[model samples]
Target: MMKILLIVFNWVGKGTYWRALKFAEHLCRRGREVTLLATSQHNRIGIEERIINQVRLVETPDLFTGSLRSGWDMWNVCNRIAWLRNHDFDIVHVFEARPVALFPALYMQRIKHISLVMDWADWFGKGGSVEERPNPIIRNILRPVETFFEEHFRTWADGTTVICTTLQQKATELGVPPNTIVMLPNGCDTERFEVIPHQIARRRLHFPHDMLIIGYMGSIFQHDAELMACAFDIICQQIADVRLLVIGYCPIDIRQLVKKPQYVIQTGFIEDEYLNNHLASCDVCWLPFKNTNANKGRWPLKLNDYMAVGRPTIATAVGDVVSLFETEPIGLLAEDNPMSFAEKSMQLLHDSTLRLEMGTHARHVAETRFSWADLTRRLEDLYQYILKTGTK
Candidate 1:
């Protein structure tokens, strides 16, 4: 069995962390010995305990607050390198391409090391030269540091894996060899999101059975609030039975839009169980992304989650979403305008046969292409290739 060491900054409540966990779990189940090194700042001890095989947690002290900033983040790379010099491992996989981690990964490669680089930052426009909205002095001060980490990490990694083709192109533009980059898209835990009876789920949530519910799940990022509010306002005006179910945290200004009881149902920052329950009850899942530079490379995780539960998705044609869904016979891709979103959503709501058919097709696509099991297999193949050839 090959021994693998996986290095990441921290494991908090994020999509990247979940993907890393699933990847580790899958590799371990395949009889590969794996060790995960993560920061202890986020109280991830519980997360460590859930894994099936050998694992270790290195608790580094938080330097700034002695509570949040893991001072050892920079030292973590050197320490891991020093430890690895004495230890033996077949491969080192770095999830986030930060300088602190890259220095160690590069060092490992210099000794003829084998590894896989999972790049998420490049896709989100973090390394690009695109102009961002002007921010306060603090943000400006920290911007350079963020850029340095992103740029260095991309240049140093041996074999790079990106979430979307847009990101892979960005990596090539940034000097990474075209052949070194591979697409390892985000995937959903389909079995966890198996279709449940819609009316039963609605009744469990105490949602009105008569109302036509449209839902949005996951974190509300930049400009999401304004776009969702504008779309919902237009949707409510046209369809009397239409109700919006928002399952995550919303900004204060956006939450105020739900004041009118007839239009909105805001379940502020729901737990995973409740969020899944509400999703199972939804008539349509909304993914309203703003047409910003950062959004251009996005492959929303919610898209797969929505599809897994057999819910019809209505989203903006931002990033690679059009390519992913337009080919599928399941969902609708609307323009980024409120009127367009409202019109498309209403059309889906009015046609029950179409909704059911689309939902079934969406679930089929997710099961065949987007399941975590299938995704892990792709990662495993990448890992095996790195081990055999030491480079892509």
Candidate 2:
């Protein structure tokens, strides 16, 4: 069995954690030995221990403090390089676009390395411009330094993988060979989200039997909360049985909007099992992302989770979301407007046939196409290719 070493900034509660976990699990199941090397904390101990036989935790000092000085970041880079030089592995997999972590791994190229660019961070400065990114104070101070480090790392890696086509194009523009870069879209773990009886789930959550629950589960930003509140108000006016179930953190100011009796149910920061319970109960799941630079390149992880249980979703047409759901006959896509969002959501709530059909299709897609097993196969193939070619 071939040995693999996966490296990332830190592994906690995020998209990266899920991606790494899925990949490691798939590799281990195939009789390959996998070792995950992360900066600190191992919060998903249960998942990792189940899959990977070895996990190495490296200690690195916090670089982002008050001021944007270069010293701290530079110190962290040196420390990471020291750690990498001491470790021996057959293949190294690095995630993140930051040069601080990339540079050290690139310098220690005794073993083959694969760099997976999850998102293009440099695009944040340009206001989505391709020719030149905006010269913000932070970018102006950091871009040149990061570029120098990235250039070396890009050239050093044995192979590279990008999450989306747009990201692959960006990497090509940045001088990475088109052949070296591979496309591996984010995916969901379908087994974890098996469908439960809606009525049973509602009973478990203590939600009313007859009400239509429009649920959302994630960090509710202020703008998102306001938009959802506005949409809910419109839906309530049109349909009396409609109720909102928000299962994540919402700011104090926004929480006030849901205070109207029998209108909204707020379960802030629920555990995963409870969140899944809420997901099973909901009539529909929401992916209300604002059309901003922050969201354009985003591939919301929740969409897969929502679909895993055969739940139809309503989302704003932002980033690669349009493409992700365009083929999804199971969900509805709307413009990033409250009126449009409300109209689309109501369409799903009012028609049980449409909901059932879409939900069935969604579950089929989740099981066949978006399963973690399939996603990890793609990742494993890329790892083997990198090992064979000795380039990323």
Candidate 3:
């Protein structure tokens, strides 16, 4: 049996947590022994550990009690490394690059002859809260150290997987061989996100029967939520009974812009348990992103959920959206502006037949291209190849 260890940097129930959990679960279903290593609060650590579908999760506890940011992060890294020393794994797959924790794992890999694979999902040192506002002196001091470890690991790893072509390009630019990089986009559970009766879902959510609902998922900061609100407001003027449904946390600034609070409904932070049902209630999904370098590298996870539920998406022509949806008629691709977005959304809203056709195309794409089964098969291939070659 192949034993694989997946290391996630944080223990949040969203983003990396969901990705790690889904991958671990699917990999386990393929008859591989998978253990997910994550970090949580001292009281919560190890308490949630359980074998679910043959995947074991072991969360290390933070050493400190309070939320002293730097101290908590440093201690968490040390704790994870200490826990890793006692375990045995044939393969170690790390989701993000953090030198403090990863360096210790690398040392173990060298001594233990364990294979290492690194995954790149987004841009480093850009747009996160810590990176957004940092002490310049510290940032400058750590820049070289961060770069040294990142490049060293990328060059040393047996194999690498990236979320998009843009990141693959970045890896090549940084001296990683093109052959070593596999482009793996985000995917969804097609079985879980299947089409539900529109009225049935709406009735459950208490949505109006005759309303045209446009929805957006994920955290508010990921995309231009204010622009989405602006686009929805414009759509409302052209079509009566148009409603905006936000399934995740909405920022206070974005919340302040909505003119008709009654027409716009925000279900802040929908848990994974109720995500599918809430997503199925939408008539259309929006992916409104401001054109930025970081945004270009992102292949939004919500795209999969939208496609999985057979809903048409009106998205900006950025990142993988152009390659994924522009050529095919699965979704409408518009320029990154409010007017263009509103126009394309209104197009979908005006024609029920077009929306239905697009939705069907979206689901077909999901089944063929973005299903978790397909993704796991591809990863299995990569794993076999890496084990055979010893390095790629």
Highest-TM-score candidate = 3
User: Relative to the true structure, how large is the alpha-carbon lDDT of every model?
Assistant: 0.69, 0.66, 0.75
Question: Best candidate, lDDT-wise?
Answer: 3
lDDT of model 1 at residue 204? 91
User: Per-residue lDDT tens digits of candidate 3, residues 1-392?
Assistant: 98888877655354666677778889988999999876654543332466766889876665444332112265566666666777888788887676534654575578777888888776654332223223677666655655555456787788788988877887898788787778888886686687886788999878888998988886645347777877877887888888888887654445567677677788886767787778888889999987765677657888889999989999988888898785668779888888999999999888889988998998888888777777877887777888888876
Instruction: Write model 1 residue lDDT over 1-392, tens digit each, in one string.
Output: 87876666653444455566666766777787777655444442222323444444333222233223322255555555665576567777776665444565667677845565655533322433222434556456646766666665676666677877777787788888877676887777675678876899988988888989998876665466677888888877777778888777664345575435557777777777676778989999998877765667656778888888898999888878888777887779898888888888889999889889999998998888886777777777777776677665
Writing each residue's lDDT as its tens digit, candidate 2 over 273-358 gives: 77677888999989887776546644566777888888999998877778868977878998888899999999999988898888
Candidate 1 to truth, TM:
0.85
Number of the candidate with higher TM-score, 1 or 2: 1
Better of 1 and 3 by lDDT: 3
> Can you give the lDDT of residue 246 in candidate 3?
82
* Residue 130, model 1: Cα distance from true site in angstroms: 9.7
Candidate with more favorable, higher lDDT: 1 or 2: 1
